[model samples]
Target chain A: MSNPTAAMLVIGDEILSGRTRDANMYHLAGELTNNGIALSEVRVVSDDRSAIISATRTLSETYTYVFTSGGIGPTHDDITADCIAAAFGIPIDIRDDARAILTKHYADTGLELNAARLRMARIPEGAELIENPVSAAPGFILGNVFVMAGVPSVFQAMVAGVIHQLSGGRPLLSQTMRFMVGEGTIAEPLGALAADFPDLSIGSYPFQKDGVYGTNIVVRGSDGGLIDAAMIRLSNLLPEVTDDPE
Target chain B: MSNPTAAMLVIGDEILSGRTRDANMYHLAGELTNNGIALSEVRVVSDDRSAIISATRTLSETYTYVFTSGGIGPTHDDITADCIAAAFGIPIDIRDDARAILTKHYADTGLELNAARLRMARIPEGAELIENPVSAAPGFILGNVFVMAGVPSVFQAMVAGVIHQLSGGRPLLSQTMRFMVGEGTIAEPLGALAADFPDLSIGSYPFQKDGVYGTNIVVRGSDGGLIDAAMIRLSNLLPEVTDDPE
Candidate 1:
């Protein structure tokens, strides 16, 4: 069976404005790949209500799983929870279970459960809360969409909390072979090899190091034997396989 | 006038497979921000034909400008040019200008301008070529979409060549203030402050450094005076303005 497909929706003005380089997308990409889920698409949109709601609905419907990060904060600008609720036409309120967790955690830290802090306790109707170990604020799963915080540490913790529940297919395996030449030199043979394999994905990444252009051929597939066989054919096709491209 | 809103479509399976972390998105974000073009949305899709075509159409219609990177190469996986043409129902084939550039570039480098390399010469009808100083493979501009190379150096050069042509509004300026408190501590006043300055965007980024939770308030706007005023109001709201959150 094919791996479950997923899409990531990264919501933040900081990212769009270039104030912050997003760490969450890269993190989730790696995590999802290892879990055997194919992360097919990623979208980064600013903190706009209509944009968020539309993107969430589209991604949730298209992919098997949809993971969203950011905008679930205490400040006024944090509107991810509300957008998620609006996307599914669900009623949301300060949930008792979520509030109880935040209350105990803040109390332990000697911080007040102020009105602003309590804003995080809001959950959509019929949604299940995902635990956040780093912060008391909980992420949630409404339908197939996984709503997590944008903060790197908190998003990571939430992913760990929920990853095991996701059913995965065969983990995609990759093998990289580097040649001390540009992709143009081996494109024909590489293309032919890709066609022959049919099942494996063959991609080339070019780089310039010390003023020399080289290409790294990455062969990826679920089957180890097929990947190994393709790599052997690739080696025979190339006149020379460089020990290191760097 | 509002800045020309833009979207980015990053095409690559390597990114989705977690083999490569995307660098182009961050680079373009900073460049567009400095150029006074508002990059509102970004989508990273794989090297699938339908996905690329559909994304191109949607982004082109929605935003003032759409920038696409990757999948424009000599190798088999390079399908962006064909996909872009198909998206607009335009014909694409080997154009003289692109082929001539490649011929000279390869002749100087002592590499054969073989059939695989010649694939780089394809250009959609009615598109203007974007010069790639790093490589001979020319990117193009078709209507609102600026199709560029995926390689960082090449992508940067293409952006620099095209950025001046795009009509931009006021450059969005930003100022940051650090408070030795969590966002929850100052959310009420911060929210009120954000409401006060409707022109400026006030955002809080919380951090835990040395076991102390602190928040960084970032004020962004097109008007420098308004951003400055918001910063002043923000200082008055918080009790302590820490020199550093680290």
Candidate 2:
């Protein structure tokens, strides 16, 4: 089977404005990789409707699965649910299931469920809810699009709840060999070796410091045998190959 | 001056595959914010040509500036330059000026500048080069698009070199007030306040503990006086408002 492709959409103005440093993308990438799903793309757009809709349609069409973070809160700028509904050409209203969850939580806390707070319960039609362990409010899944919360803690919980339901392919396997030699001297040989092992993906990242040069050669592939074979060949070609802590 | 909107395109399969965690987006966002530029969107696409072209065109048309990170290296997957040229309906070739810079760098290191490595010198016509201090290979600017390297160090250097060239608007100012209360309780009042202060952008981010609820309310605007005025009203209403260390 071919690799399963996934994409992420981060919707927040705080991130773009540098007020908030994003943690969701990195966390999702690591989780998706471990689950054998290849995350193919990520788009971070503001709370604007057109931007979110345009990006969602394009990415969902290109990749097998699309996961969106942020803009699902009960604030004024939180407009992801409505935009997703618009993109899919579906009707949006307060789903009874979601309303029940929020209402129960409000009752437990002895608080009034006002219109502003109830906005969290407003989900699109024909969508299944993804449990939010951090808060009673939940995210929803519509077709291949998984809409989750903006806050990192809640987003993480929703991701855990939903990742098990996804269909995934073989997880990627990688090996790294770092050498103190200059990348210029190693480029041709490494490029030729990479050509020989067409199945394995090779990357040469160069580093310089205090008049010294170094390069980290990373070999990645889904097949373990191919990855190990390429690594052996690489070690023979460049005798200085050493283990990289990273 | 009106706020200049910008977007970022991060191109690399390594990041999507979870082999490499991205640092370029955060760095660029911070630099853009400090320079008074509003970064509205960021997209991370794989090495695929069609995906790159589509994202580039969409973002470039929507924002005042588009900064791309990654896919500008010497390897085979580095196809950002070609994709960008295609997006703009322009032809691409290895220009004399870029070739000159690359040739000089290879000459200084006494390394052979092969066809594959020379791919880095190929840029769109009528583009201005962005200087790379760490490595001699430079990035370039074509109209509103600034193409940069994916490596964290090189990408940062390029952003620093090019930030001064773009015109920026009045710097966005923000004031934060934290309350030790649940977002549900504050939702009604905050929503009304936000509606009243249509000129200011107010966001409430909630956090939960073992049994405690807390939230940070952020007020943003280009006008400092307006933000301050809103903050005063918010503090008076909440009565539990306190300074947020973040």
Against the true structure, candidate 2 reaches a TM-score of 0.90
Where does the lowest 10-residue lDDT sum fall in candidate 1 chain A? A237-246
Candidate 2: list runs displaced more than 4 Å: A207-212, A239-246, B89-91, B103-117, B208-212, B239-246
Question: What's the TM-score of every candidate structure?
Answer: 0.97, 0.90
- Superposed by TM-score, candidate 1 places the C-alpha of residue A12 at a distance from the truth, in angstroms, of 0.4
Residues A39-153 of candidate 2 have per-residue lDDT tens digits of: 8888888878998999899888988999999887776777899999999998999889999998898788677787877899889999999998777888999889999998888
Q: Assign candidate 1 its CAPRI class.
A: medium
- Residue lDDT tens for model 1, A1-246: 688999999999989988888988888888988888989999999999999999999999999999999999899999999999999999999999999999998888777888999999999999999998888899999999999999899999999999889998898788999888788888899999999998888999998977888898999888899999999998898666543321
TM-score of chain B of each: 0.96, 0.92
The DockQ figures for the candidates are 0.61, 0.45
Candidate 2 collision pairs: A70-A150
